[model samples]
Target: MRTSTFLMSIIVLVAIMCKNVVNGAIAEGGWMTYCQDKTKAPEGALFACFRSNDGGIHYNGRDLTSSVIYSNPSKANEIAVVLQGHGASAKFWTNDHTVQVYVKDGSSVNYSIKPRQGEGRVNSSVYSSSDADVVIGK
Candidate 1:
C-alpha cells in the first residue's frame, strides 16, 4: 500500500512539472502575444503575452475610437480603447487559428492570447476587407 501511494504521488508530481515546462516553452515561443481558442488548444497548454509600459489608447466605437483596437462581430467587451501605458497589442497564431491586431506605434504593440468560447473575431475601422492579414469577411 505504501509503495503504491508513493508511486501515485510521483506520477502526479511529474505531470505537474511537465506541464510547467510545456507552458514555458509555449510562452517563450510567442504564444503569450496572441489569442487562442481554448477548445482547440492542447490539454494543458496556456497562452501568455508581453506587456509594454509606453503609452496606449482607449477607444469606443463612436467618439472614442482613436488608436484603439477593434474586433469583428463587434462586441463592446472584446475591444481595447485604452491599453494603458503597456504595449500596443499581441497576437498568437495556432495550428488553424490566427488573430491579427493593428497598432498606432507598431513597435509598442504587445498582447497575449485570450481564451474564448465559440469562434472569435475582432472588428475595427482600420480593418480593411482587402487587407491580406484578415479572413473573417472573406
Candidate 2:
C-alpha cells in the first residue's frame, strides 16, 4: 500500500511539471510598437511589436487588408517572418530557425537580423500591397 501511494504521488508530480512546461511554451503577455516609418506604408497600414512571456518578440503588420506575422526567438539573434493573408492563421515554434512568409492575396516582405543583434536593432523591408512600403529600424 505504501509503495502504491508513493508511485501515485510521483505520477502526480510529474503531471504537474509537464503541465507547467506546456503552459510556458504558449505565447502570452506581449507589447506592441508601431512602425518607425508610416509614410511609406500603404493605405490603412498597421504594424506593431508584441513581446511574449517567453522573451520572444512578435512583429505583426497589416496593410490594405492583408497581415503578416514575424517572430524573434528568445535565445537567438535571428528573425523569422510568417506572412499570411486575411483570415489565415499560422503557428510558430520557439525552436524554429528558418525564415518563412506567406502571402495569398496582397503582398509580403522578408526580414533579416544581424548576428548577435538585440531586439531593439532590426532591419526589414515590409510591404503588404503594390503601394505599401514598410521599413523597420531602431
Off by over 4 Å in 2: 30-138
lDDT of 2 at 138: 28
lDDT of each: 0.34, 0.36
RMSD of 2: 16.6
Error of 1 at 15 (Å): 0.1
Task: TM-score for candidate 1, please give it.
Answer: 0.24
lDDT by residue (4-118, candidate 2, tens digit) is: 9999999999999988754442223221112223343334333333222233433334321233353333422223232333333333322222122334344344434332333
What's model 1's lDDT at 102? 37
Residue pairs with backbone overlap in model 2? 31-51, 33-49, 83-102
lDDT score for candidate 1 against the true structure:
0.34
Residue-level error in angstroms, candidate 1, position 77: 21
lDDT value for model 2: 0.36
